[model samples]
Target chain A: MTETAVTRPTEIEWHGVSPKYIAVDLIGTAVSALIFTAAATVPYWLIQEPWALIPSAAVLLVHLVVLVLTPRRIRSIRYALRADDLLVRRGIMFTRLVAVPYGRMQLVDVNRGPIARAFGLSELKFVTAAASSNILLPGLPAEEADDLRDRLVALAESRRTGL
Target chain B: MTEPLPPRSDTQRPEEREGLGSPLTEGRGADLAGPLPAGNPRTEGAGFEAQQPQPLQSLATAPLTTSLADGEWHRLHPATPLLRGGIALIAIVGFLITNLRDRFIEGFLPMYRDEDYSGDPVEFLVGEGLLFWALLATLGVVLVVVFFFWLSWRFHTFRITAEIVEVRQGVLMRTNRRARLDRIQGVHIQRPFFARLFGAAKLEIEQAGDDANVQLSYLRGHEADALRRDVLALASGAQRAAAAAAPAAPNGVPGLVEARVQELLAPELDPAEAAAESVVRITPGRLIGSVLLSSGTLSVLAVLAGLGIVSLVTGEPIAVFGALPALLGLGTYLVNRITSGLRYSVAGTRDGLRVGYGLLSTTNDTLPPGRVHSVQLSQGLLWRPFGWWAIRVNRASRSSTNAQQQQTRSLVLPVGTLDDAVRVLELMLPGFDAATVQRAAAAKGGEPDDPFTNSPRRARVLRWFSRRRNGFALLPDVVALRRGWLWRELVLVPLPRVQSVAIRRGPLLRALRLAGVHVHTVAGPISSAIGALDDADAQRFFDEVATGAVRAAGNDSSHRWRSAEAAS
Candidate 1:
């Protein structure tokens, strides 16, 4: 009888992030992981010390687990456009759901990293008066991101309110 | 700080002083060449007015002394030069003269020629018979320093129009900062001990964002209050009314010495000025008791006891001695906390809420309606029996440069009882629901009669002590978060001030079917967050609050409170 997101009949339809986002997340994590391993194992390469391999191997193992979880992480990301706010939900083990009202939005930004742009993906960010309301919705097709940005801008304009 | 300028001119002509003050006239006649840009338009056509046998009373108040909102550039207090950097220059010159007094005596009289020099550069110059050049160089340096101070004072000017308050300053690279009147969060007047000696006060117009605040340092003390009132009046959207009815300087003209003596003797919070007496009376006993009962004091005691136990167990007295420095530091902090709590006052004014504090160097700030973003009332475990609560607020205005000033400014009520707390909240949030706030304050846990949606029993795993007490309520205009069992706390964030709503769940929370909620407001002393709520309730809370926030923001016309009234 316990209520959950799935059981709520009145809950609005939630949209999942693009599947291609998994590649972006994995590639981004792999690049950082490789850099971290290289930095950690520098002593082994410079002094031919065997103990350095322990740290690098441990880092590699962690990265491999993360690589396996990247797809589920992408699938976990969901957003819903309610009547007055844009609701975003993310994270698996540590779940967070944020609702940013259109009126309080100070700035709307659309950015694309090199890899994201290669995959025709863009990340949308919303800036509100409170710095704590750091909301970002990533992994949207470039065209869709642009369209969403324009729609949000218009909505924000119509419902503009002061801080 | 000994009367940096001659007092003769300032004391003689009360009439001329009423126009531009002694400092401005002295600066113009001393060095600056060209005639300044007719800065005082009001004084331009005052020939006939001046000739008439004026009413001394009206002339004393001097409504035209500073037409702040006249849409023209105006210079700051004439003492701005000395207050800014002239004091440093004076100190440097004084130090040089004192250190080289022997050299000077030897060079001039030849009687002390056998005396040993201080081995300074001046000593070497005198020994090498280059005393003339050294004296000339010192004079040159003094002249250059004086010229620069004068130039800076001349360049630093501020202008106030209907919509914006702009200040531009810089001798080389001109810098201009404009704060929109509509965006002004509050106006603060600070009188440091030295500044008060010079009959000056710093007027700061608080604005949002990083480094956005505009400061007009060292304005005439009497004028600072008037200017702040005019600015607040304009910011409240009563520009026309304020321009027509700006309060004339309250007291009639007193001579220079009389005025300074009056200012020095004035109380921290003048009952005459703050028409509505302070809502709470903070007796000396209560102030000291509150400080001693604070959690900080308890921690200090705990550390001391631990040190004593360690010393006894180890049979080493040095253990206690080792903690002396840390204990002294903690003791100093406690003493400071108590001293600063003295002379604190908060009252309601016609324009807004007035809060004044500090003993020697006082600060009086006025926050117009709707400026406060969130309010928090908290009680320590030891304070429970006394029914004491401390109130703090999250406001958009902050002095980013000074962290200490920023912290003290946010605490509207440092300590008070439940009734006093409610009254202070009412001052901040006009027409707030007192009954709901009372219930929120009084509830211990699992109070079915209370309006707040109490956390379910399942949250006990995560918040064993606070499970029943931790909850949130959606009031008519604000979202209230009630938390803590031993240390009770409540936070109220106005619906219009809520920037965003968030719900979070970690692995433990998920297993217990509980979630945490955060109602984002401006960054300040208060944090509007609560944990261990029913998962379903959390979701519903987010949905309803978000929707309510949007509606509240749309309906909010508090920004131009007076303007709305005028329009209707």
Candidate 2:
């Protein structure tokens, strides 16, 4: 039995990610991609056919596409914390968003790898009791990450304490 | 003239409480057996207020949390250690004795013919009284086990303090686990074959916090039952602590003291559960019929028939043998499903609901108020004719790997009629409106013209095979996703339990102008996929679900007792 018509939700103001994080991810991917481009030469060396260049060219083309698209992919990864839930949106094509409620958050952690440490950035992770609900917001400024983490911990504590 | 009860703890002698708490635990725990609805108090609230002390003042009841108080620490039955260690002891002793005979045959006897030897080692050992040494070693092994058993029995103790259920165990690394009484969700009493014979059982007191479940085992059957009631009574009494402040029943608070004494302290299982009407037991015919009617059963039969045909045509006859792996794989899955769902029964209890199932290994889990986070009612392809629905819920588990696997752990009713499914759904979700739920369950076709927004006919070409069944139904507390044509599945995620919501438009879907609202829950079989909704419908559903989840989560408070204390 339908009764009340609900109002539309306000537009989500997404916070863009730190660019240095993208540069670091690009360097690693580019390095591995270069190795693949180099490895593709093996078939050309052994087969000694002009057609083999087509295969080698394809690998280089894939690497080129990745080099071009990697930055855009990073730019697409955005997160926003609302009044009661944390919303993360990523992927340009598939476009996925997870709105994790503050009350449902069981654990929140900030992790920094060596590259992220050099870049002064870290990943903020929210762990909920649900198996599928774990959300990782990557490539955030270390300070921003820690601040968000503390706020998340505080909000989760307050909301959960309502029981 | 009468003073208001001082939360039960301030007035009663500790000795009297200890007497009422454990003595009735032996057998007839009928009084304390009713489930406590907590702050959602009705008749029992006043009764609980009178008999039990407030949870906060539980700290005032006991002065020390250090070394066990003389009477405070209750050891598991002395034979508990023996029960745990005896099997290992027997096996080790048996192995050593058997090893001696084997050694005599292989090492000693073979030495005469000489396979391999290092200067008659066996003969030298024999001369040094090998039999005596062997016997001594066996005795030493037995003695060590006996010593450890005694140490474990002596040190391990469980006690219900004013505010917490404390369990302390271990000889060297002593662990004191205290479960906050107010946070206690449920208690499970497991009676294993060996323990049941000795009239002993194990109590697992479930709390909301991780690894916070208090497990104490091998208690005399009666004592175990009483301790379970004791914990529940104190937990429920925590809510009524405020009611205890008033001289007479104040503002709709029921008889908490009388409820605690007569309903919780009296010895007997919950009377409500004992009545046959409260239970839905699976019959043998139903069990067999469900398995035979299952899609899995049909697929297996189809595969076998195909293999048989292939074997006949080819005449190699090895085709049947080649498909053994697939046959075995499906066999295990079929067996697992049947056994897991076999002999299942869901019963209503004072606290909430108790679900027991398993053909070979059974689990009797008690789910108290508000433990379930989400629920799903699904109809499989084959079971549609039978009007059977499988009701599964997402309850926070102890520890799990991922989401989908965890959903199966919270299975409330594996397979049941429409009525049984509704009854269980009501049990778990107290706030869910029954009328809406019934309407949703009875929904045959979720059409654009009907109640729900149907997928555009273009989706018919996209999902040409299973186009008819893909639709969604929105409720106040839950968002229902119905999918699949032959093996249909209905996934329901409570707004509050929604970890996140995703509006995904695949390249194909984007072209069709359809976006799916993918509601992610803890990994489980219940995947809420409200797919093929038009762009506007999808966007609206996503936004509304996101907001709904936020509102529901905000309304739920984890600590009601704390609020009650603040209010008072």
Measured by TM-score, the strongest candidate is 1
lDDT of candidate 2 at residue B136, scale 0 to 100: 88
- TM-scores of all predicted structures: 0.84, 0.72
- In the order shown, the candidates' DockQ scores are 0.34, 0.25
| Alpha carbon deviation, residue B404, candidate 1 (Å) | 1.0
In candidate 2 chain B, where is summed lDDT lowest over 10 consecutive residues?
A: B1-10
Model 1 has a DockQ score of 0.34
Evaluate residue A106 in candidate 1 and report its C-alpha lDDT on the 0 to 100 scale: 66
Tens digit per residue, CA lDDT, model 2, B1-568: 1111101111112322343222211111111121221222122223322222233334355333222211265778777975676577569769967855656676567655545444555556767778678768868987987888887787776666655565556766555555455556567766555545455567777654334467787776555655554454345543334323312211343364554333223223334232234446567677667777877778887888898899999897798887797789777876777777766767665456777665433445667655555677877767788878778775543433343324445667877887888887776666666665566554655544445565767787676655565777677787777666666566667666676677776667777777677777644445666667677777778778878887876665422313333345
lDDT winner among the candidates? 1
Off by over 4 Å in 1: A1-3, A6-10, A42-52, B1-66, B86-133, B268-273, B297-328
Query: Which candidate achieves the best DockQ against the true structure?
Result: 1
Residue A138 CA displacement from its true place in model 2, Å: 3.6
